[model samples]
Target: MTITIDTTRCIGCGMCAYAAPQVFRVVGKYSTVISQPEGRRDPKVSNAENGCPVNAISVTR
Candidate 1:
């Protein structure tokens, strides 16, 4: 599975960064993808998805 970030929907709130710092982080005022990349097994991906208030993030297999 992989987590995708909809840049258009992202408001740059930085909430995703705070909830799952290991998988998500903030860069230049916008949320960014960290070390864990697409198709990589991750433990906190679900937490990151839930943290997004606008539902800007999701995981797919």
Candidate 2:
């Protein structure tokens, strides 16, 4: 699985980092995916994606 953050849609809220520090981080004014998930079904990654207020996070197989 792969996790990606759409910087254009991100508001730099830091929720992803807070929810999944191992997989995300706040860089500059955007949230970025910093690590790959253990798999497509990783709960941490999924929580981060769901936590994004702008829906900027994407998870793909």
Candidate 3:
């Protein structure tokens, strides 16, 4: 699976970054993709997606 952020929906909240610093982060006013976290699958990314207040993050296979 892959983790992607809908920049339009991102509010620079940085919740995902705070939840999983190694996998997600905010760059300026938008959510940015850091590196895919190790030893995990779609579920791991989905957790990050769920943490975004704006629902900006998406996990897809």
Candidate 4:
């Protein structure tokens, strides 16, 4: 799986970090990926992508 965040579209709401602490964190004024999931899929990652209010996160397999 691959995860990417469009920084231009991100609002720095920290929802992604809130949804997946192990995979994401709030840095400065943006949410950034801390680590990728070892598995092909992660529910927390999906939740983070979906929870992003500005739709800045993208996940692909």
Candidate 5:
């Protein structure tokens, strides 16, 4: 899986981090990818992408 965050659209609400702490983090008013998972098998990653209020998170496999 590939994860990407559009910083311009990110609101820093931390929902991505809250949903997938291992993959995302809120930093300086934007959500960022902290680590890349091997694939989309991790459910939290999907939750993070879906939970982002601003649709800043993107996951592609």
Candidate 6:
């Protein structure tokens, strides 16, 4: 799986980082993916994507 965040849609809410610190971080006014998805399934990552108010997160496999 791969994770991507659309900066334009992001509100920098930090929920991604809160839900999956290993994969995301809030830098400045945007959420960033700190690492690539290493073919691992993470419930927290899924929760983060679902939790985005603007639906900025994307997961592809």
C-alpha lDDT score of every prediction, in listed order: 0.76, 0.86, 0.77, 0.90, 0.87, 0.92
Q: State which candidate has the highest lDDT.
A: 6
lDDT of 6 by residue, 1-61 (tens): 9899999899999989999999999999999999986767789999998999999999987
> In model 1, which runs have C-alpha deviations exceeding 4 angstroms?
37-43
TM-score for all models, in order of appearance: 0.73, 0.90, 0.79, 0.94, 0.92, 0.92
- Determine which window of 10 residues in candidate 4 has minimal summed lDDT: 31-40
Error of 2 at 61 (Å): 1.3
Q: Write the per-residue lDDT of candidate 4 for residues 1-61, one digit (tens) a residue.
A: 9899999998889888988999998898888898988877999899999889989999999
Which segments of candidate 6 are over 4 A away from where they belong? none
lDDT per residue, candidate 1, 1-61, as tens digits? 6677888788889887777787787777567787555665555677778778888887787
Which candidate wins on TM-score?
4
Candidate 4: where is the Cα deviation over 4 Å? none
* Shift in Å, residue 60, candidate 3: 1.1
Q: Which structure is stronger by TM-score: 1 or 5?
A: 5
lDDT of 5 by residue, 1-61 (tens): 8899998899999988888899888889898899999944689998888888889888888
TM-score of 4: 0.94
Write model 3 residue lDDT over 1-61, tens digit each, in one string.
5778888888998778777777787788987988865555745466678777888887765
Model 5 misplaced regions, further than 4 Å: none
